[model samples]
Target: NQRVLVTLNGHPLRRGLLPRADGSRYLLFGQLVCRRLGLRVGDTLRVTLAPDPNPDQVDLPEELAEGLEAWPEAAAGFARLTPGRQRGIAYRVDSAKRAETRLQRAMQELEQLARMG
Candidate 1:
C-alpha cells in the first residue's frame, strides 16, 4: 500500500486517494487543503503526485483518548467508525486552545456519538 504527496497549484501537501462507492479512486481537496492552497471551485489547479510511504497516520488527541478510555461504549463506537470519521472526531477534539475546553469537547463528542447509536 502506498500513500501520496501532491503539489496543488505549487502548494505541496501529502494525501491519499480515497475510495469511492463505485470502486474508483479520487482525491478530495478538503476545505483546509483548498484554503491553504488558495484554491476554489472552477479554478484551474496544477497537481503533481508522488508515491508516499506512510498512509494510515492520524494524531488522536490525548484528551480525546482520556474521554474514550473512561467511556467504554464510546470507545467501542469510535473503534467501529471508519478512519475518516475517527480523524474528524480527533480534529474537533484538538480544535480547542484550552485543555479544559478540549476535554469538554472530547467528552461531549463521545456522549453525542453514544446517544446517536
Candidate 2:
C-alpha cells in the first residue's frame, strides 16, 4: 500500500492508495471528502499526488497522550497496533468536537488497549 498526500481542486487530503487486481492503484474518497468537495460520481477533478512525508504519523490527542502516559502496558499495546489502526483510533478521538467527548473517547481507547495488554 502506498500513502499519498492528495490535492483535489486545491483541497489537501492525506490518504492511502488502494491496490487493484490489475496492479493499478486508486484513491477512494470518503463521504466527508465528497461532501466537502461537493463531489459526485462521474465528476471530473484536477488531482495532484505526492508521497506522504510522514505516512505513519498520527496526531495524538492530549487526553489520549496523558492516558497512555499513565498506563505503560496500554502504551505498549498501542505501539503494537498497525499504523492504520492507530490512525483510526486517533481520528475517533480527535474528531470529537467537545473536550469532554474527546476525553471520553480517549479513555475508551485506553481501556481497550489495557485489555489488549
Candidate 3:
C-alpha cells in the first residue's frame, strides 16, 4: 500500500460509508487526492494524516441500506442537515462497533439537531 499524502490543495473533503470484507462497515473520510487516485469499491488505501503522522492502511466500507433505512427519523434529520454535516454524522455513526450503538447514537444526534432550531 502507498501512503496517501493529504495536501493543502486537496479538493472537496467528503465522508461516506464503505464495507469491509467481513460485512462490517467503516466511515471513510477522504479527499480527492489526484485524478490518478483511482478509487473503487473494495480498495485498500494507505493514508497519512499529516507530515508527522503514522500512515495507516485502511479498507473502504460500504453503507448498508437496511441499516440506514431502519432509522427513518435519523434519515430525515440527516437530509435536513448541510451535506458536509450530514456526512460528518454519518461517518461517526458508521464508526460504531455495534448496530444498536450506531442506531442509538444516530437517534440522539438527530434529536439534538432537531432541537437546534
Candidate 4:
C-alpha cells in the first residue's frame, strides 16, 4: 500500500494505491468523489499520480480533538488504532456541515473509542 496524490480529469484526490496479489495497483475512490465527478464504474479517466508528501497526516477536527482531550482512555484507544481508522473517524466528524453535528459525531467517536479500551 502506497499513499498517493491522484488527479483524475484535473480533480485532486488523496488516496492509497493498493496492490493486488498479481502485483497490479489500483486506487479506491470514495462515493463523494465519484458523485462529484459524475463517475461510474469503468469510466475512463485522465489520471496522474505521485507519492503523497505527507502520507501520515490526517487533519484532526477541533471537536474531535476536544473530545479526545476530555477522555484520556478513549484518546489512548484512538492512538492504538491504525492510521486509516483514525483518518476515517476524523473524516466522519469533519464531514458534518454543522458545528453541533460535528460535535455530536466527535462524541460518538469518543464513546466508541472508550468502549474499545
Instruction: Write down the lDDT of every candidate, Cα atoms only.
Output: 0.76, 0.88, 0.49, 0.87
* lDDT per residue (tens digit) for residues 30-115 in model 4: 77577778999999999999999999876688999888888998999898998899889998997786889998999999999998
Task: Return the top candidate by TM-score.
Answer: 2
Best by lDDT: 2
Could you tell me which 10 consecutive residues in candidate 1 have the lowest summed lDDT?
51-60
Model 1 score (lDDT)? 0.76
**What lDDT tens digits, residue by residue, belong to model 1 across residues 9-101?**
887666768888898878887675666567788998788998765555555789888777888878878877877777789878877768898
TM per prediction: 0.53, 0.67, 0.36, 0.63
- Report the error of model 3 at residue 4, Å: 14
Residue 35 in model 1: shift from native, Å? 14
Q: List candidate 2 stretches off by more than 4 Å.
A: 36-45, 60-73, 94-103
Tens digit per residue, CA lDDT, model 2, 1-117: 799999998998788999999999999887656876899989999999999999987668799989999999789889999999998898788777689999999989999998887
Residue pairs clashing in model 1 are none
Off by over 4 Å in 4: 41-44, 60-77, 91-103, 113-117
Q: Is candidate 1 or candidate 4 better by TM-score?
A: 4
lDDT of 3 by residue, 67-114 (tens): 336666545655566645654566576677677877677666766655
